[model samples]
Target chain A: MSNSTAFSRARFAALIACFAATSPALAQPSTVGFDQISAGDTAWMLSSTALVLLMTIPGLALFYAGMVRKKNVLGTALQSFAITALITVLWVVVGYSLAFTPGSAFIGSLDRFLLEGMVYLKSSSQLSVSHIAPTIPESVFVMFQLTFAIITPALITGAFAERMRFGSMMVFMALWSLLVYVPVAHWVWEPGGWLAAMGALDFAGGTVVHINAGAAGLVCAWMLGPRSNFGKDAFLPYNLALTLTGASLLWVGWFGFNAGSAVAADGRAGMAMLVTQVAAATAALVWMAVEWLTRSRVTLLGACSGAVAGLVAITPASGFVNVVGALSIGLAAGLFCFWGATGLKRLLRADDSLDVFGIHGIGGLVGAILTGVFADKAIGGVDSHLGVQALGAFATLIYSGVVSFLILLLIRSTMGLRVTPDQERGGVDLALHSEQII
Target chain B: MVHDDKFPIAAQLFIRLKRSPGRVIDVTWMLENELYALEVLKVARGADAESAELAARYETLLRNRKPGATAAPQQPTAFARTSSFMAEPEPVPAEVGRHYVGSLR
Candidate 1:
């Protein structure tokens, strides 16, 4: 065998050994039976699932909606809602299988397509093994994860807004979810996937969600050329109030996003929730401070954006680091993202429109790389996984960027990337819907 | 020229002036003719009175004066001959001032 192949095999063996060594023993049946699950845990999980769904449906949707010009508000909001609905159906049909089903080392097969042979009544199945809370029904876990799948592609839409055709967006989102998002999610989260087999642990979705979505967003932004008014006129956000509200919802919903990854109502989940809050708070303050020192004012919009950067940064490491690690990550994310959103984006000349790549993509990368440096075994039960984490992160970045670029090119060649200049100036809402925003 | 009654302020002012016997007909006619000429010039040129006055003064100066030796603006010299002619301000009657002051109070 080639050296790389042998190395992969050895790494896979080490992962299996590690899992076997640390695996918790199956609890024996008590006289009280499986009814011992705390009511608090069930309540928290149920609420968290709703919060995560909220993050995509209205949180991200309205956030992006308010960022675009007034003419495109309804179109942006409608597209987000549509993607949420579409992904929910797709996840039930085939997305879940490709992401979570048991298969080879690369990807899962179509055994669970259309959710065939999957019973909702049963609490335990092959699918349940992937979750920390095996007692919960696999259907619940699938629904919770489907929200993540929905938001990842929705995040990319912000990069190419105000110009892309609605039909092309639908096709691109469907393909991206299937090819890019699913494969990466599997590699990071699935037991048999290559990255997981290499001992990479993403507590939430630092690599899988933020990095994967951010890279794709950057590629899409580049492929869909700058807006017609770019550099010639100002493209300020139309409504800061709407963006503020959306950002606040994102902040609240992120607890569910990070803590819910634990899949159990345990000490680990509690720590994850605490660290996520601390990081986000610190990052918001730090970002506001930077803007004040540099720009002579503390803008509400800046604080909100900083909070999101913190959330993105802490996503991968929330489960692995202590409060100090969370604080440091937050500070770095605040400063780096301010630079990315303002200075770097200005230099690059790509109109990311909403800073999707700057905040999500760059923040996710920072979080993923730092997770290697700060991951402590005492806190998260992740030990000596730094090298594997770096490999997983780099692999995600390359795959996502390249695949996303190719997909964008294909879409551009076949259906065209940007709308006509007239259509864009008139607004996508009117162009596509034949109706004005009320 | 006949007076138009549509503009009461102008008609009243003209009637009051006509009743004042001490008013000079030659000077009144000259002023009236000059006012008519100014109005015509204003309409034709689409220029306000301020601009028209500046243009008239510039034309008069150009027609009557010689070029300066240095090709610069002509400087007023004490040795130059001066015309005694001067423009006068319009006068208001004592009763008119009293009535105007009464209206203000």
Candidate 2:
């Protein structure tokens, strides 16, 4: 590693060590004593955070860039990289504390602004234990959750791919993260929040990440209108190889995503990993078979899209459901998401540039609802109601949709949202960033 | 809100270009706003070796055009976005002259 990289590694090690020693938590009444912190679980969570971050950078970036036309390739990828940095800044400044700290049923406070407790950490050797996660250090949990915060809004970029001013997108993501992602995250993940109190199950962010991004993506698509040549033009993907590579990375990294949500390297994590695999495989086959029947040929794009569908569908059910549940959800996700991308795309007529609504949105909505049905109590010791799951799904759709629409409008009014016809024709990469594949 | 019809800008934003069968060069944009027009030109050229020379020429060209002159639509620039494998550029309106240039793709 380079000197800077080595220094960062050292800095991170020190921080983790500081977090490992939970001196402040001894005073709090808790089952897991402050004397004990699981190094094994901390190690896993740390790795999981890196994996999730990877999902966005090269993984998600390559996936989006490959799907867009050659001119739009770099611009599409740039959004993901830009969001990762933007969200990280927001997360440290106030996002983490507001979403995770105690305040009301809907939102948290600025008590931990700038990650105050984390950086200084009360004499630099001690850290507080979050009520939600008793075994792992709060620092570990915070870093892990921050990764989720980064990717949610980044996923929405797929909607208004070739259009959308970059400045408008940045502003939209910043506001959306604070207004939409933070509140929803608090509701589902934070123990004191409404959704958690109501016993809604989101193993790894079906509602907060996928559903929220998908809904926002739909609204953004509607707000931005279609790409200039939507109905008339044939915009073929620039590269399937890059997309396939990205999808493969997403599949591999997802073990960390689902299993790591367990917050432990225990039996639950093992089962979560197993279910993830089962569901992804089942969904891929189902999507391919359906595509073959429909188009008389099974395209590679269908297979990759299928895998992502399964991942999104199983995300909420990963911890609650059994192997049987995984298979069922995966199969359903393949069939449903296939329809979502094709039938729904035609029905909506909105140029969701990358099927964000059709795949992630539809899949997440279905996944959340199905979690209620497939959430076998005997397997994961959690029972779910179908109504409650539907409530969570619709709640996210309404909240993200309305909020995202307003954010987009605000951005549009302020600094012109879409690029000019000249810029669009020139390609956003060359036009905006002055970069091209050549 | 600078409406095209309501508020006529003193400068005419028009690109003057020459194109051969396979290549295009010496594209000059005449506009009211010098800095902004140069910014757009820089975006397309992007730190190329010839960028400085081409920009200087465009600056000299823009100086010649009188302000508020109506610009007829120009032919598509020769170096329009084209993928090696894909023949046609992205589709737009029926206008802009070139249609389905890349017949193979």
DockQ, all candidates in order: 0.01, 0.04
Model 2 residue A115 lDDT? 73
Model 2 regions more than 4 Å off? A1-35, A119-125, B1-105
Error of 2 at A139 (Å): 1.7
Give the per-residue lDDT of model 1 (tens digit) for A74-167.
8888888989988988898999888876555556668678977555333441232233346455556777789899989999898888888988
Top candidate, metric lDDT = 2
lDDT of 1 by residue, B1-105 (tens): 423221232333233333432221122222234333233333323344443454355334334544551221242321121111112212446543342221110
Q: For model 2, state the Cα shift of residue A183 in Å.
A: 0.2
Tens digits of per-residue lDDT for model 2 on B1-59? 23232112111112221111111221222232344455545543553435444555655
Model 2 residue A56 lDDT score: 88
Worst 10 residues of 1 chain B by lDDT: B81-90
Instruction: Spell out the clash pairs found in candidate 2.
Output: none
